[model samples]
Target: MTTSTGQPLAAQRILVTGGAGTIGSHVVDLLLEADAAEVVVLDNFARGRMENLAEAEAVGGDRLTVVTGDINDPALVRDVISGIDVVFHLAALRITQCAEQPRLALESLVDGTFTVIEAAVAADVKKVITSSSASVYGLAESFPTTERHHPYNNDTFYGAAKAFNEGMLRSFHAMNGLDYVALRYFNVYGPRMDTHGLYTEVLIRWMERISRGEAPLIFGDGAATMDFVHVRDIARANLLAARADVTDTVYNIATSTETSLKGLADALLAVMDSDLKAVHGPERAVNGVTRRLADISAAARDLGWTPEIGLSDGLDDLVTWWRHAAQPAVAG
Candidate 1:
């Protein structure tokens, strides 16, 4: 669904942390399309891109302000959050980065998020939509993992931080009456995807290699799968989470479909119109998880949201955008 169809958050002055990053950019774009009174994007450009904000800026005009600052800066967060109606916090260290630097991750994800919530509480903001990860599910033992799953498996520092943030939300909600929605996103990929972050989805890394006429490499037997969702659909999810009546709750943001790496590679090849075969490599233990598919019933039932882009269509859209962006421009 297009952003215009959503219930307008009348006179909302929203703040989207990391608003220039891959998924965050889409969030900002949709907020503008839904006619938020103003959208203030707070990002440090560590992973965020300036060009990503172009579309939002065009639509937002004077209503959009891009703040250059880190989330760990409590002072900056407090100042930026004033007069904000709601917040969509997406800024955080990558999973791999968090794994490599635990201390930094602690301060960034935990302290950083705490700072956001604290500021929102002080400002008496209306709502908060936190972007969490599916990593917390950690080697699911059941199909279509539901929100009622057991406490997060001690997987990685990134997952730990996400779980901690959820706790903080619940506590703040109980104590200070904070209204928030926590979304655990699955293996998300689309246009403006990042490969250097945490775990590079084999889809992107493979596409990069195949575009260079190399084989799409798969780890293990390529039997393991992931529930992939498009960034735009995720953007839509963020919007719904922001406006929906659902509060003090968590939902899995996914399309409820699993596609193996082999399947994903084949889809990529077909999209690129290439004939290269996939190369299977030795399996590494770090690749974790045999398969994953989210139980999206809660999101559908509570938020009235469902992902529209399927695997083939989403990958096609992603490949087209990536290919155009990767091409060298001729001198005008």
Candidate 2:
């Protein structure tokens, strides 16, 4: 498969930080499919699983190398980043985790990102593609938020970390001429989603309840909305960003479609063919961003990338995967 720029990924030495996670693993698989010369995965296993890289290992053979390491270790990061053509910096704590552990968030998201940027520049990597988040647009003032939107209202530690990382990338580009692209992902859901997490997405929680023939729960009348983009589409966006000539800019990677909790529950019920209705509960104290919809025109115009999977189709895929995978018990 050719990159978005129609250039083959063949013989390219790529490094994927957090490559064993959901979206990162998908990127590894796609990179291997594109016949990258060497795909090295550096993951500390904080949230990543070894099983996620099973398929890539089987298919990649000598082309793939899995390194058990931390991105915060400057020596380690520099060592692994050396001789790499492109770097995909995806390692970070979850949003909830970051909110709970501010110090860890600073170390992992802030310091770790600094290590990545410094190493990538020192290594003279062709391009660095990193994962940003829509959380940066916390409590957005406008709908269909664009990349140009400032992170003025962002209150969460996670959003602050992501915003800082983006700024660091731009600063590095200016000072060290480090080429980079940050993809601000929205609500990402698909196979390999972390259903066992303490702060899981509503989709995962609802699915677990529905599987047990229990009513799905929605918080605060289910008015809060998000832009749910599929993991596969996110992985594709990474590849497009990696190959595109764009640099020192951020792009929103989402479906450009808003989905409310109530709508999501209904869609999942229909997809799973369940008769259970959603139950409303008190709202949890979390990031209070009530609405999320992205303007993906920049990604489309620049990287030539657009989400191919609709919410319905993506939900069907998730449901299928959930049925076949182990169903872990989740707390309500």
Per-prediction TM-score:
0.93, 0.96
Off by over 4 Å in 1: 1-8, 195-200, 327-332
lDDT of each: 0.86, 0.90
Model 2 scores a TM of 0.96
Q: Which candidate is the best by lDDT?
A: 2
For model 2, how does the per-residue alpha-carbon lDDT over 2-98 read when each residue is reduced to its tens digit? 3232234679999999999889999999999988999999999988887788889999999999999999999999999999999999999999899
Best by TM-score: 2
Across residues 1-332, which tens digit of lDDT does each residue of candidate 1 receive? 52221234657999999999999999998888888899999999888888788888888899889999999999999999999988999998888788889999998899999999999999998889999988887888777899988655558888888988999999999999888999999989998776454445556677778877888988788898889999999998988887776788999999999888888888889988999988999997764778889999999998889999988899899888877763322211
